[model samples]
Target chain A: MQPVQPLQSVTSAHTDRSLQLTLFIVSLVTASVLGLIVLFIFRETLPALSGPGMLRFVTDESWHPLENQFGMLPMLWGTLASTALAIFLATPLGIGAALFCRYFAPRPIVRPFRALITLLAGISSVVFGFWGLTVLVPLIARFEPPGASLLAASLILTIMILPTVALMSEAAINSVPESYSGGAAALGLSKGATIRQVILPAAKSGIFAAVILATARALGETMAVLMVSGNVVQTPGSLFDPIRTLTANIALEMAYATQFHRSTLFVSGLVLTFVIAALAIAAHRVEHRAGSHHAA
Target chain B: MQPDSSVSCAPGLMAAPSVAGSTLLTAQVHAKLSERLFVAAVWLAAALVAASFLWIVADIAFHGFAKLSWSFLTEAPRSSGRKGGISTILVSTLLILAVTVAVAVPLGVGVAVWLSEFSRRSSRTARVINIALDVLAGIPSIVFGLFGNAFFCVFLGLGFSIVSGGLTLACMALPILIRATESGLSAVPHDWRQGAAALGLSKAAALWHVLLPAAAPAITAGLLLGIGRAVAETAALVFTSGYVDRMPESLMDSGRSLAVHIYDLSMNVSGGDQAAYASALVLIGLLIVINAVAIQLSNRFMKSRIQPA
Candidate 1:
């Protein structure tokens, strides 16, 4: 009986080891693929670094790649400004949704409400873009110079980030120990008072993390903005003005571009990636700080 | 101007009365004010969200409904952008969607199953994989397109083909699929595992019997969401999938998708605004139908998992 049990145990160990090795290889492959993508992007962007007017191209706002002129400042401005608008538009709606779902909504209603936000998140950017083009562009035309403007892109992007913020905020709020709420209750506080004072403050760090992630999402958005934001190479001062985001610039012109122009677009991508990474790092820092504080 | 995040509140403020069902003047006023403001804010957001949809739908219904025709869907794209149906683009889009799902779903599900049922989340390897996935998910589709173009289009010489685009899209769906699978597997009640073991089932058998079935709905929801994303993606496919208007004969054929068609049509439009609007409506309609199905599933199936509060 002892000899039989040892043989069975050895077989199981072999099976488990094989499974683990196979799975590890797959995950590693995925990681390597991502690394490869970054490398190739940098490789593509190299020529643009040495192009005739590389510095001038980025420093100036004029961005006609044709006729030996290329400037990325307008693209940078449009991307930043539009993303800011999206963050502003989404934050309140998301926070409110989180608050309602966490406290006010009934158990049955809460799940459906959360699902609706997630539904918005699942919708593809192309569909969002199409929705923006047919729906948002014409709608914006009434108030804007170009049918597709920075504001239209911002509006669409707000919907895109809403679910991320709301879900994250809800998780943060729920993770707060009930003891905090209980203490507030023992002190003779109203539900709203407790939520505002004890609950929100405790969850502030996580909420900030969520907001930062939403900001990253807004920055990373491409298709929907490409559809709604007028693909103009100009720095937008008014919300209604035609504008080009860094993302749209890459998507719209990458097909037709040649030589140094192609590399410059990749460079644009690299810069955007760096910005996104920075935002992610900031969010990680917030979560890390919160984690340590909670531990302490 | 401010959404309250403050913790300092007036103490002794109707703690018992609210629970005991008594209303004082000051407390009543505060409660009334709070309720009014909260309700207003929440409902207004809902309305705003709803309104955005309405504007899009109304515009499409107004335009596309007027011009709906068999020819508009069946005929090949024309030089005028107004003279033909989106049949070629539509078919190509469908093909790409099918290929993408076929590849992405199984691969995604397999990895997810392996991750959730096999690996410990606390392991350094798992943490690294998880972080890598998060970074991949956050990378812009445009960046994905750039990579696809450079590696697959130019380098591998899979020049502007459906397979190239579909492969790129599979990466975009990975995180969603993995996250969903992880959450779903975790959601399977722990007792089920113990019960299976008690019945003398192997670990794999237990997972297949007790866990997979339970997690199926959630995983399917995630898959559907991935489908929705794959359908709506444009950037990564732009360079990889050539703007060839013909239907793909095989996975190697280059083709334009609905989104690309719209971009091409809108940019190249010469005669009128009506054509762009009409095409936009078609694209939006298709997307709405797809997303609405996903929404229904999630709303019904993932109730406990969602965070509203």
Candidate 2:
């Protein structure tokens, strides 16, 4: 009986150890996926990044691919312009909606409001693009010759990102300690004054993180921007002008591209990866600060 | 002149304190007015956000609802989607989704279990894994498309096929699934683990029997979200899947997904707007159903957890 007990214990121990080891191996493989993606993308972009025309890739404005002119400045500008415009348009509305949800909304309305935001977020980007093409584009074309322009892309992006920004900001606001609001009330501060002075300041870092994350989302959006941004590889002088973004550029031309052109598209993707990485790092730092502040 | 001076002097004597009181009243009024304005503006913003969502849904339904029919859901698309249905695209989408779920769910759940159960939160290994997941999450889908093209399609000889696309989407969806599941597992009470240990149950038995079931709703929610994201994906699949509208007979066959079909119908094919709208309607309907199921599951889980044993 004693020998059997020891053997049973040993078998159970072995089984547990093997299970743990298998899980650990699976986790390691999962973690390495990011590294693999980076390696493959970077390796593919090496030709364009190290070529003689490397300088021309960033410096030149014309992207005449057949002529070997692969200047990405115009597309870069388009990406930045559309992202900035979307952020500019979305931030106020998003933050305002968050504030409303946190402080001003009636109790019965809050849940439904949040569900609406989530539903908006769940809608596919292609659907948004389709809607923009059929509905918003024609609306814009009433005032302009070509309806698909930077403005159209930015508007769609603004709608797409608003839910993200609002949800994150509401979370940040909710995380502010209850005592802060109580103290403001004890001091006889008005509701508006308390929100503007105490809560917003305490939640500032979190809101900043939310905006940065949303910016990353807007920058990476492809199909919607591609469908609406006219896909012209030229710099736009005005909001109404049609423009192409880096993401749109990659999606627009990846299918038929060969050799250097293919590598150049990869280069654009690599550039996007770097920028998104920077934003992610920044947002992480800000969120960490906010978390530590709350802990303290 | 003496009578006028007396009248003015009497009013001045009375008006001195009244002026101070009037200014204070006006100040209060100004604050109240500004507060009202601020509240109104916030409501307006919220209303606009909600209204935009309704407008998008309404616009799609208005355009596409008329075109939807039994045949549209069951027949193959004809004339570049200017006519017929999206049955092939629907099947391809489901197949790709199945592949993505089969690949991502197990890996994501394993990582979540490792992070929440096996490793300490402050450990360096866990931190590295967390950072990797964060970076992975931030990576754009188009970049995923590029990597999938380079790695799965060309390097591995998978070529442009549903398998390649599904694997690519699995990579894209992994981080979100892991984070969601990890949070769910972590939310399980610490006392529950101690209780299992006190009962002399093996760690794996306790996890499989107790912890996993407790966290099942969360895992389910995470999976549904992953499915939603993968189904909605267009950019990542466009290059990997090769846009063949025919019915995919196997994982290796190239196929066009619903989102990609909508994209092509709208962007590449002229006179395909009606079909695009109908496709969009179908895709949105699937997402809303997924979202509702997630909400229902979470709500039920919350209620059960709150109830006393």
C-alpha lDDT values of all predictions: 0.76, 0.89
lDDT of 2 by residue, B1-309 (tens): 222222221111332354455655555667678778878888899989988899999999998898998999999999888889999999999988888999999999999998999888899988988888898999999999999999999999999999999999999999989987887787788888888877766789889988998899988988888888898899999989879999999999999999999999988899998898888999999999998787777667766662223
TM-score of 1: 0.83
* lDDT minimum window of 10 residues, candidate 1 chain A: A1-10
Q: What share of the reference contacts survives in each candidate?
A: 0.45, 0.82
> DockQ of each model against the real complex?
0.45, 0.60
Please list the residue runs of candidate 1 whose C-alpha ends up more than 4 Å from where it truly belongs after superposition. Answer: A1-13, A50-57, A102-115, A127-148, A179-192, A284-296, B1-35, B69-84, B189-214, B270-309
Docking class of 2: medium
The sequence of per-residue lDDT tens digits that candidate 1 reaches over residues B1-309 is: 332222223433434433333334454566668957766786677556545555655765687667667788888877746777778888888888877788777667667777787778898877777777777777888898999899988888888998888888887887888787777888776777787777655566676777877777778877777777777777778888878877679989997887777666655565534655666677666666766775666556667643323
Instruction: Give interface RMSD, every candidate, in order.
Output: 3.1, 3.8
Per-residue error for B165 in candidate 2, Å, reads: 0.9
TM-score of each: 0.83, 0.95
In candidate 2 the C-alpha lDDT for residue A102 amounts to: 86
For residue A243, give model 1's deviation from the true position in Å.
2.1
Q: How far is candidate 1 from the true structure (C-alpha RMSD, Å)?
A: 5.9
